[model samples]
Target: MSAGDYPQVGQGWAFPPHWVRPVPGPASVVTDHGEERIERSLQVLLRTLTGSRVMRLGFGSGVDRYVFEPRTPDACYRLADDVRRALLLGEPRVIVDSVEAVAAEDADDRVDVVIAYRIDRHRRPNSLVVPFYLAGAR
Candidate 1:
């Protein structure tokens, strides 16, 4: 089945919320669908901190815990585990294949989180690289 055919992974307002204005009409909020929608949802989930949302106190990945910690192997492994767990709980449409946290080659303060996944029953696999910044890491 196509991505659009999956009801569980339907359309939603795009993340990093922005407005789009048509040539002959008013501005409207941008929307996302299918795989793009899921990717954006994952970005949101990773960016949010646990307990930050009043209604959904457990709705985030809590990766902020690593922001000030050293970018060691142990830290990377923990971060990967946190991401995998968060995605499993927050997003039901994806089956995670792997999550890896590795230091960025070009930047000392950046860690690249590589996530490999497949949506529900589809055979095609997808990947996303999210950069985690360690602003105060030593």
Candidate 2:
């Protein structure tokens, strides 16, 4: 879908019930379509945006691995792998679990652009906010 189809920009996937508080397990929703959602969101944002404003994702170890990988010298095709993995196994937890991992990953350098999961409910001292400020500055 296109950015217009998304309706909201920078907002990533929601944590499936599995990742929810008091039960941080495998959220079937997250386990099912999290990564796909993120990849699509990034694609849509990149297509819709005017400049290279960093992308911050709240993903997990898997999300951090591929999306953050410097595949084409300057390009990080992280979601490509995640999508592949999901497609291969027909899973979503891996994708959704990675959604919260965005705080650790360096996308847009902040917690605003494409942040995923429970950032508002689980803000830590080191939670990424650089982009939030940068976006605000602009």
> Each model's RMSD to truth, in Å?
2.2, 16.0
- lDDT by residue (1-138, candidate 1, tens digit) is 455566678877787789999999999998888888888889999999999999999999999988888878888899999999999999888999999999898888888999999887755899999999875344
lDDT of 2 by residue, 11-128 (tens): 4444333444337555333332323454443334323322234453322223333333333312223433443343234323222223222222344433222323221222221111
Which stretches of model 1 miss by more than 4 angstroms? 1-5, 135-138
Q: In model 2, what is the error at residue 87, expressed in angstroms? A: 3.0
Q: Residue 112 CA error for candidate 1 (Å)?
A: 0.8
Give the per-residue Cα lDDT of candidate 1 at 93: 84
Q: lDDT of each prediction vs. the true structure?
A: 0.88, 0.31
- Model 2 off-target regions past 4 Å? 1-61, 71-79, 92-138
Candidate achieving the largest TM-score:
1
